[model samples]
Target chain A: MRVPVLIRRPPEILSSEITDEGLFLNRRKFVQAAAAVGAAGVAGSLLRPKGVRAAEPGQDEDKLTPYEDVTSYNNFYEFGTGKGDPVKNAHTLRPRPWTIRVEGEVGKPTTFDIDDIWSRFPPEERVYRLRCVEAWSMVIPWFGFPLADLLTAVEPTSAARFVEFKTLHDTEQMPGQRRGVLPWPYIEGLRMDEAMHPLTILSLGVYGKVLPNQNGAPIRLVVPWKYGFKSIKSIVSIELTREQPRNTWMVQAPNEYGFYANVNPEVDHPRWSQKRERRLGELFKRATLPFNGYADQVASLYAGMDLTRHY
Target chain B: MNQVQWVRRVLKPAVFVAAAVPFGLLVKDIFGGTLGANPVEEITHRTGFWTLTMLTITLGVTPIRKVLRLNALIRLRRMLGVYAFFYAFLHFTMYALDRAVFSGLGLTVGAIVEDVAERPFVTVGFTAFVLLVPLAITSTKGWVKRLGGKRWQRLHRLVYVAAIGGVFHFLWLVKADIRRPVIFGAILTVLLGYRVGVWWVGKGRRQRAGHVVAAGASS
Candidate 1:
């Protein structure tokens, strides 16, 4: 296995250029401005969600969830399955000293330090509505770069069709791992194209600060358009594979959770209706949007496929 | 007034107020903005908890009276069961309202009926609540006089079945972390166990008495 670092890509193939043509043309200027601000140590403050300054193009303008809600009400089941369990029990997690093993069918199978990945891909604020499979939603201002950038750096092989993410599995820190609620070392995966989608981000921060431990600190996947569980937390490994990898939730209950796991209101989970969702901190439930309101950007990915059957 | 009258007028009213405190607090929390994030869930969770709590308490009334000889506690069981139904009603209403936005028609009979039939958790909970309706209605003195004591008692035994359904509803709905529902299940087991034990011991006593009478007559 070989390890690689920050392999620069052609300017056109950049994940940032894939979005808007205007933003693509102004990429150099944005990078220069970001570099200058990054040098001054004001990067953190600049990325903070305040007014229109933190609003990114092609993202939701919904009111961001309160920092208290974003931090306290979490679904990181490693700590525990309860909504409040992570807040109370994740104190034992040591996020700083962490390394992610990036391997499997890539040109360079590398072990990258969490900090290295953070610096290599400068964080960008993306306000996303995170809808959990359990029918609750929250609009979170996540700070991270695209997963495409990370995959680009590692250089996936042509044979690689899926990317699997493995979460931290320390029983000492994550008390819930000791019990059999879910298979330990929770696993989640995405198709190669879905993994390379511009909206799929490797989140490191929320509300402009480094993530709280309970909210998957160090590093985590944030696939905004999919169910929140698809965005695996406290990631420890990224493996590119030829075959579709088994996801934890899907493995536990296949009928309830499918491999696609896209946010589709039309296809209901076996246990409950998916047409509506309770947005956190909101009084009334809101009608769920197809692909979590990212249908324009992501709907084509599933063209000609039977979503109900896939679901 | 004497002690019996004092207990009837003052103590019974006190129990009623105390039993109502949870619902009042829930209402206050809704208006006070203190139910925290996801107020719908908070409302659902709290009301569900109180429903099960009151149901368990109601099931324990007979056992408590028999053990401690506090027969006046029998008067309080009706109020306790009513509170359980009241909370269950609130729980069902909040759940409907929570899901109503998805329905084409808002809070209509069709939508509720569809949900009750479609979702297993809702089905069980709705069945439990529907069972409680007759119990609450027949709890009145007039209904008791009309139905007669034996038939009334038999119909009221359905509360035990309703209580089991409520627990199963809770157990089935949880995504993960079955600890809370499991704890509730344990409590129900103990309450039901006490009732079965009392019946078994009484049957044994009756059998023994029959044998003794037969033996004396033969001798």
Candidate 2:
């Protein structure tokens, strides 16, 4: 019998969405043309930092805040204080041809170009919940690698107890720096354990695109579990110190901000509550999770210490 | 209608719409996807700013009438005060939504309660809104009649206290760049200064009148 022969199709290996690819490519061209015309003399290649494709099943599922919102609404006081000011002002910031000096307690004490660092640490997609002390949150799809990789490469000495980060201090570019706003060239620090945490990353982009100037272009730190300020932006230097370094916020307002700055719902800021946070896209405020919902990964680091007292 | 009657009939309503334009524009912006990236924060800030603006304008009415002898301006004071309360109410409700009440869904009463009780900025702002409630309720002619003029005046004096509270609430909440709040502080000071100037001038005139009458009676 030539009758009923079963015909089954092979399982599909890849599924790609059929959209207007031409339009996407055209828009990218437009962006390149605009960047080329800008006064900052930013080359197209330098304007967009190409990163390795992060593996699929990425945090794309974690309800991202709109790219517009992520770029427009920022708290980069280096640009200005207003929520919208950074987007308007940070356009002047030239992030290309950047170099970061890694000194203090490191054996190499190297000064590496931003491109070199990017090569060393291939990008990975990390969707992290960024909670600001101001009680607002955003789910950012950060393209970066574990800071541990960089720390490992640098080879921190045994005496290295803390890692201090410093941002670039160019008054002409960073207008807010001209004004004495919290002592310019903002500084942030982390303990050795916190620095090595896999969750801690050095971010170059967000939402699979090169980070916009206001979102801290080129490179910035992303300590997901800690308060957003702890993730200092537009990093220029990394120093390993023996003592706990003086963080900018803590030095400015010790009573309000602390060294650890771990996202603790229990430890309320002096002026505002930390119990709840308003996620950017949401209308209602949700209860803030301990360690920004990374408690499982980072809580172990703070085992014996009292977070409340430290905060 | 006569000029006086026409002004009474038409001008007040125009001012009412003018005062409410900010709120209407805000609502339209919210729906039109133009309230910027952080819509909740945009809403909160716009409403809060309008509330303060309305309160400042309401406080300026008496001074404007007395200094410029534009007695007709006094007619707009109650409307201004009511508008201030309307914006203040929106400001308060938006705060609940912006800060503690909403996430992606709707209201969370637990977070709201915790914020009202625990956060100093929220506590001060909530208190200021609560204090405005009585003044807003008594704004109507019926309520004013029920309270009686002297008692009503005494009750309404609480607006100054509420204004002070509002300024303090703003001062406490801002992280840095207190320039805007300080400017508002200056405006509030000037408004209070006018009231003090009037009171001092009135006190001097009354004391002089008393002295002249006493001297005339002795003579």
Candidate 3:
């Protein structure tokens, strides 16, 4: 039987120098295409650090079509508002040949290239239950290993109680960012322990297809247990810090969106009824499930706290 | 009306088809499988949009008639109001089905009653729609002749209430931006303002005429 669930695509980039494992190392096409993209990125970003253009040939390019199933979809207000606007507007993003600046409260301060970071963590295919803050959900098969692997590489000290991530902000490309409609350079965070959770994966791609421009090309954090907004898209920086980082939703409406946005049917959004959610594609009326039906795995994360209060 | 009446006669069918195209296309789409995986949201958004559009059109009739000096265009007002309710019915269908999980299969009445009681936005919107049903049923020339112009005018004033309700419905659903709702509010305001302004001006003219007649009789 074909399971009605989401499947993630493989990354366009893999290591050119194959590791001894040779597991995905045999996938050479992914590597060469990545190099071509990286070289272009270096030439472009070096040319104009604050520049944008119609998605260059290998800058996570795809032809515009009116109708197609969205491989990556989210309505996270912080990552530029609008449902379909992200990918259409994020064309000027310089994703490849990039660097993730990891700092603060960590034993080692390490800045790694995109290729090196991919090698540091072994990639895995995980089918996660995705719940949106709006209450609807989908099951996505994602590619990438545990975020815990990234934590281990950085070696966060005990004082490193939170992990905050940031997205690149260019007013030209991300017009929504230019507007004060939302705080720019969308920020998201997790308690150090939550960041280290096994289910938390730094997702690279979906549907066995490379990251679509709309879906946060290159890399994004996918925290399946929490609401979709908790998972930031198109990540640029990851820092281990003691202080909590400013999150986008909370800044917009503190009462409605809490820092810990878990998928609990009991806790409804302030403006609308949360008791029921309209599942995407269900037409009009479909009942919502609790914990997005992942209660078995993630229920332990919020065992003691009053979710209604935090929510 | 020599020229104006001819235009109205020509536009009658065109107007009817234009108003009906949405319901027809929606029904055809359901069968054609053009609606994506989430068809209910698709249908609801489409229906709701038309409901608002029709309401706006109904409100626009008087303004257009006044501005263009085409008083006969006012005849289109009733048909437009009826179409607003018709599209509203489709929007209600999609919302009901999408929220069916809240009410189990075949138990829609209870669910409907319960949801309206709990959700005030839906409650007000549905109430506005329910009131329009009677006016729609009584829109015939026979009913108008029986009720007389005064009574007919009074009964049909519910369109104002329905317009207010429609604006509120748009206001409640949208979360992020307030721009769309504000635009609808401004349009409704102007439509209502025009009616009051015209009535005040007409009333003053009649009072002045009565004073003139009384003075002339005394002389």
Candidate 4:
């Protein structure tokens, strides 16, 4: 007998949900052609919002941050610490021919080829508001499938309580790893429930094109309710563990960064205020919301736990 | 032309133009839409960087003059220090506008006061800026003469303290990867170390001179 469905799949695509086949096929061909020249060419072509779906209900209604900003202004320490460093340095990262090994506390441990996973779960477009701990925010349209689909396929054991992710550790490709800026191969984790949440997606593309190398090419986690750092980048391996896994920032500065990095405006970062955030390209700063404004759906996950203490 | 005339007419103006280039470029970038996604942050960082850089160079003036025997370089120090203050003022203004008015905090003094009081980085940065204010005001020749050489010299030493504060402000602000701050700290250490070395040698010389005077009188 088949194992029970561990997590819900995204709802079936309705007849109206389908796009014009000819237009979709042409767009795909154009993306492939751009990809042939180089990643740089693809970057220029993909930035235009052509054939992108509208924001799903409950997604942020704010204007999407410019693609240049999303790709240029990143906090990927594996590439470098400066916001612009990733765009300059991430060209060293090779995204194709990548594989993710899913193992530990799973009934069927498997290594998934990046292409296979792409074909297996056709990406769905999602607009999410990503708020950084530094009090900057962005509205991004990410194209990817629910991560629950992967975890369900692996069939997590009952003992598994946390899901841990690891970025690639090649110093040649990721030169920033050579410097002891942070513990190498940047690691992040989420509670099993958080991992299985419908909002958590394994993003392969953004702005209707293949993910830019700077913005965690190949695959990255996008947990909208959590701080941007919680959504780890360039994931190479995933492990389900019984104990809560210590994330990179948590390891680096335990007092400042904690396991549950849910966006809570009430809890200020020790060094700076978290009550307000400057949405990229806006002149005025806006008051930040609870769970980056997804409290309605995600607040139940931390019902009785003290967020300030966890943070 | 004489050395002083050449410095006044040619060298000083050249240094002033060179110093102002970063600010000019920043304005150009702001207008050209090349400051990237976060232009405010870009402006803040660039201005702050130039502030610290001018402070470091100001501190370097004496060490370089002594080592290279290019005392003409002394003429440039006051201008450099003034530039540091200029950038510090700009940096702080950017922050105030970003935090107070643009942030929708209604330009209340309380918002800025709270930031200075609550954040250690802001505290140190504000301290550096406050220390520079008097130095910049008293930087004119007339004020220097009124204060007298010894008093002015002693007062100007506050630049060292301001430099220390500025370096720490930078060190504390970054989230991680402190290579840049550490580099600034290392350079400051060497500059401060040179001063200590000179002071120690002068103390020894003075003590030896006193001994010679005593021997001469006894004989």
List the candidates' TM-scores in order: 0.82, 0.82, 0.80, 0.89
**CA lDDT of A42 in candidate 2?**
15
Candidate 3 per-residue lDDT, tens place, A10-126, comes to 343463432322333233235425444221111111112223322211212211111133453446443455454565566666668777788888888888776776766646556
Model 3 CA deviation exceeding 4 Å by range: A1-73, A76-94, A178-180, A276-289, B101-108, B203-219
lDDT of 4 by residue, A1-311 (tens): 11111122334433234444345435544643544421112211112312333222123336557677888999988888899999999999999889999999999999999888877887776768899999999877677888999999999999999999999999999999999999887999999999998888898877666789999988999998899999999999999999999899999999899999999889999899898887776656677889988887788999999888988
* CAPRI grade, predicted model 4: acceptable
Model 2 — interface RMS deviation? Answer: 10.5
**Per-residue lDDT of candidate 1, residues A159-235 (tens digit):** 99999999998898788899988988899999999999888889887655677899998899998789988999999
User: Model 2 over residues A57-139: C-alpha lDDT tens digits?
Assistant: 12222355656778899999888899899999998899988999999998888888987876667676565789999888887
Chain B TM-score for the candidates in order: 0.89, 0.89, 0.87, 0.95
Error of 3 at A278 (Å): 4.5
lDDT for each candidate structure: 0.80, 0.78, 0.68, 0.84
TM-score of chain A of 2: 0.81
Q: What is the lDDT of residue A256 in candidate 1?
A: 89
Off by over 4 Å in 2: A1-61, B1-14, B96-114, B143-151
Candidate 1 vs candidate 3, lDDT winner: 1
Cα RMSD for candidates in order: 8.4, 10.8, 11.0, 7.3
| Candidate 4 wrongly placed segments (more than 4 Å) | A1-61, B215-219
Cα lDDT for residue B143, candidate 1: 95
> Runs in model 1 with CA error above 4 Å?
A1-61, B1-18, B68-72, B101-107, B141-146, B204-219
Q: Please tell me the TM-score of chain A for candidate 3.
A: 0.75
